[model samples]
Target: MRKLAALTTLALFGLSGAALAQEVTLRAVTSFAEKTTYSRGFERFIERVNETGKGIIRINYIGGPKAMPPFEVGNALKNGVVDIANVTGAFYTNVMPEADAWKLRQVPMAEVRKNGGFDYMAAIYAQKMNAIFLANFVGDNPFHLYLNKKITGPDMAGLKLRITPVYRDFFQAQGATVVQTAPGEVYTALERGVVDGYGWPITGIFDLGWHEKTKYRVDPGFYTAEVSALVNKTTWDKLTPQQKAILQKAGEEAEKEGVAEFAKLNAEDTEKQAKAGIEAIKFDAANTKLFLDKAYEAGWAGIIRQSPEHGPKLRGFFSKAN
Candidate 1:
């Protein structure tokens, strides 16, 4: 009788522990497909959290753009259609025009946190989009222009470029007619002559097979590109304090790994693009300076125009001038 009671008691305790481990499960989505560079950061973050969170929490990933349009993700987070998302600010500028200022970030996210930049963005997201600004997953990789048609200098005359909000004003200022196309559609756009080129970081051309159509990469790349993780405020509030801490800590770990690996990949990508038949287009030093200055100038002009109150305030956090 004593042995029977002990066995029953142990079984119940084991069942109780199992139930306690699964306290919450949150759904996550990325703006791009899972196997792509843009999704790498979020993938690592999810890995860390799932490992560390074992019984406490589990993130249910629902896949990417095919699951939902990239541009709709910001609204999805705002409206609570999903608990978490990985996306670039450029894709969701409608949620916060001040977001454009992030592309201008000249510092790593670790420094941004120490300087209170992260706190400020967190507050902004809470108030404006009903989301929590989670860790910045990847950044500091500058964007270069990939073109089928060549230009000897900064002049982009007679070019039609596919623009993300990251480079709309800058590209337009340089005499290019800009079109917006979804990532999956860009290949068709280029093939169909809807765009002569597109703006992208050094790393993704081969990933999307754009190198097949790309003939040149403009040197002296422009503004930094970044991807960030966010959690819906409602979902965030529902998590236990311990669960929140696990997520926060995992995000930091993932970002550190992501940034370092991304830097290494950027170097390899440039080399790979060259071997894949993409040429490096360049201009003299004088022309290079002229080009970069025009880019940053028009970039800030458009940002401040759209977000008069916060754009200037953000320059301190996001720019070298700060």
Candidate 2:
């Protein structure tokens, strides 16, 4: 009868709607410009996860800083205004002070993940930042001082340096008048002589056109650049077990492969920097030891000073990692 046909049609349409509802698309943002190495690397992670997650889950990268400024992205994720984000620890230190340890710690990513380091960080993020620490994508390349003036030693006295939480203590210890500046503002600060130099990842100076202003790379780079991908805890909690497993697998794979990708790019960029006339201050044996020792001491001490209760326990992992 016509009534039976109508009922059947409604049932079919309802089933179709249900099927569409089964697919999930998470909105993600990053703390970098779209053309930068960080974005390039993170997009690859999104691609791989989307490919692996096909029907169940999809990540739509909404955009980078244009969508949400770098410093504000973490708060967006925490409040569920964003489902995911690729953010740096420096941006979220206010949300989770212990996050500074992620950038300052000397342990390699492999060891960090293998030992309890990543899980410890995940717990911290979950409890304090309202996010899940998915994985670290850009940690292979370390940070270096990109300066307009050349210096022979670690004595940064009287220089106005742009700093992030990662290098603030170490640079301050070296006597530099550290100015806290956001990544996007560094260029204007440099051009206006608001800052004499800045610290950045070994591979990304060219991305921001900073190479044009940089004349010297103070060698013996310090601290692994820890750019982490995070998922909003509310969103994470709502995922099906299978979707969670897929995301976890994708994050692990991205972390493993991203290391090699960054390594290759770092070498290429270092060469490009040399050709572009950026001088390197080569460290001799004694200077190399002195520089690393002082840098580590300054970094670890700062972390402990900020979060005494958790700091020593976390730093224990670094010693074990060695």
User: Which candidate's lDDT is highest?
Assistant: 1
Prediction 1 TM-score vs. true:
0.92
- Cα displacement (angstroms), candidate 1, residue 127, comes to 0.8
RMSD, each candidate, Å? 4.6, 3.7
For model 2, how does the per-residue alpha-carbon lDDT over 1-322 read when each residue is reduced to its tens digit? 9988866976877666446448789999999988688877678888988998888899999998887888888789889998989888888877887887776666677897778877887888888888998878875788898888777787888888999888889999989999887788998998888888998988888888887888889888877777778999999999989889988888888788777888898899989999999999887888888888888889889888888888887887755344
- Point to the candidate with the largest TM-score: 1
* Candidate 1, 248-269: lDDT as tens digits: 9998777787778878888999
Model 2 stretches with alpha carbons more than 4 Å out:
1-21, 320-322
Candidate 2 TM-score to native: 0.91
Q: Kindly report which residue stretches of model 1 are placed more than 4 angstroms away from their true locations once superposed.
A: 1-22
